[model samples]
Target: MPELTGWAWALLALAAVVVGLSKTAVPGAGTIAVAIFAAVLPARQSTGVLLLLLILADLFAVAMYRRHADWKALVRLAPAVVVGVLLGVVFLWFADDVWVKRTIGVILLGVIAITLLRRRLQAGAGADTGSHRIAAATYGSLGGFTTMVANAAGPVMSMYFLAARFEVKAFLGTAAWFFAIVNVFKVPFSIGLGIITVPGLLIDLVLAPLVIVAAFFGRWLADRMPQQLFEKLVIVFTIVGAVYLLVS
Candidate 1:
């Protein structure tokens, strides 16, 4: 384990809780957890650590929302996601820690931009009806790449679900399954990259309970929270996280 201060551990615990919350309630909000982990650990190491935590959270999400998943959508996106993940692995092979951090920062900003653009287009077009195949391929590839690179694919996937006009529960359910499967798929690759270390695994074990507790809490909050307010807060926090990553 990298020698971290008490404050860094505290922040990581909070981020772990956020990871669970994002998995269950706010779709794209987990990017904040990604940002915090990256800021506190080496960017590459952070991806591995966050990936395990996310997989832990994913179990709860899948259990809570598994019945609501749209299997057809998952099937549609699978091939493209694989392609993007392979591309991300290639990118990771050559990029050093500094490049990884900067790339993550850039990706965060791009996610935010893509999210905003999605909302605007949705408001104008109202529930995408043009091309499901095209939409699935585009978003799937982007989601795979972002998740692989920085664990920042929540917003990208959220946009895709929104475009598909998924109901709230369905969106959550689909997202839960999407990440559960995808995160597990990435494990071998992450291991191959030598980023998933014993120290990181130890840290995940220590923080696992918080993630579990937060997952339950988020499930309770899922239906009750005001969507517009939650989304706005997520966007603000995401921007702050992106800036910090860029400048730090």
Candidate 2:
């Protein structure tokens, strides 16, 4: 493990908690954790470390919301997502750390823009009624690529679910199962690429409890939050996290 200062440890711990919170409460909030982890550790290494924590949170989320998943949505997204993940792996194999960071930053900003545009359209008319293939190819590709590269798929997937007009529980349930399966899929790729390591696993072990605590806290908060408020918070946090990534 890299020797981290007390402050770094604290930041990472907070980021871990955010991962759990993001999974259970605010879907896009994981972007903040991504930015923090990337800031404190080497970009690729941070991605590796964060992945384990995300999966830990995913487990909690799946346990809570597994039955609510939209299996049709998952099936629609699977093929395109797989392609995107493979592309991301290819990119990771060749890209340096600076490129990785900048790419993530760019992806964050792009997702924010796309999400806002879709929301505006939804408000002006009705929800998007594009073909399922198009939606799957578009969002699923981006979601898979971003998650594979930066563990930053939360915003992309959130936008998709929102556009799909999923009710709160359905949204959480679909996202929970989607990421649980997706993150697990990424593990071998991450390991083969050396993004995941024994040291990263050790760090995750220390932070696991915090993730559990935050997951339940998030569940409580989500249960109480109004739908509109929940949506707004996700957008706001996504914007904040994107800006942090670009400027940091």
Candidate 3:
């Protein structure tokens, strides 16, 4: 382990719980975890640790929502996502710690903006007239880049699924599968970039159980929490986290 203080461990545990919740219930809130991890650890090491935790949570999400995924959507996104991941790898190749931190902050703010836009558009009729092919390519590539760079692709992908007008379970299910596959695909690249390391793996072992428990808790909370309230809270926290990352 990296000899983090008690406070850092607490923050990491909280972020782990949030990751589990975002996986099973709140779709876009994982960005908050991204911010927390980034703020507490080195920018690059934070990405590696969070990626492993997310993959662990992904297993639970897939088990819970696997049957509901829309295979067509996954197929549509694969090619563009691959392109974006490659671009992200190139970016990581050249980016130093400060650049990675600033980029993540910018991406986090952009995610918030996208989520708000998604809500506003969802309130109106005929908000999805864009071609499905174009939409898929655009969102897939963006999602891939963000996920690779900062593990902050939830809101971007959420916007895409919402624009597609997926029902709740379908949205969660498709997202579950989408990330499960993508995150796995990212492992080798992350390793090649030297972000995924033994210290990060040690931290993941400590936090993995929290993710498992919280994922189940999220499933229970999903039905009870008011949607409007959930969205508002997530946006507020994400903004705070994003700003902290930018100026820290």
- Clashes per model (N, Cα, C within 3 A): 0, 0, 0
Output the TM-score of candidate 1: 0.88
Ranking by lDDT: 2, 3, 1
Which segments of model 2 are wrong by more than 4 Å? 122-130
TM-score of every model versus the real structure: 0.88, 0.93, 0.87
List model 1 lDDT by residue over 8-122, tens digit each: 9999999999999999988777878987897788777888899999999999999999999999999999999999888889988888766866776786677668657766766
Q: Which candidate leads in TM-score? A: 2
Q: Write out the backbone clash pairs for model 3.
A: none
- Candidate 2: tens digits of C-alpha lDDT, residues 168-248: 889999999999999999999999999998888888888899999999999898788889988888778877776776676
For 137-177, candidate 3 gives per-residue lDDT tens digits of 98899889888988878877876786676766787899999
**Lowest summed-lDDT stretch of 10 residues in model 1?**
122-131
Error of 3 at 110 (Å): 4.7
Question: Of 1 and 2, which scores higher on TM-score?
Answer: 2
The alpha-carbon lDDT assigned to residue 74 of candidate 1 equals 98
- TM for candidate 2 is 0.93
Error of 2 at 207 (Å): 0.5
Candidate 1 regions exceeding 4 Å error are 104-130, 230-245
Candidate 3 ranges with C-alpha deviation above 4 Å = 104-130, 226-245
In order, candidate lDDTs are: 0.84, 0.87, 0.84
Instruction: Please tell me which predicted candidate would have the highest lDDT against the true structure.
Output: 2
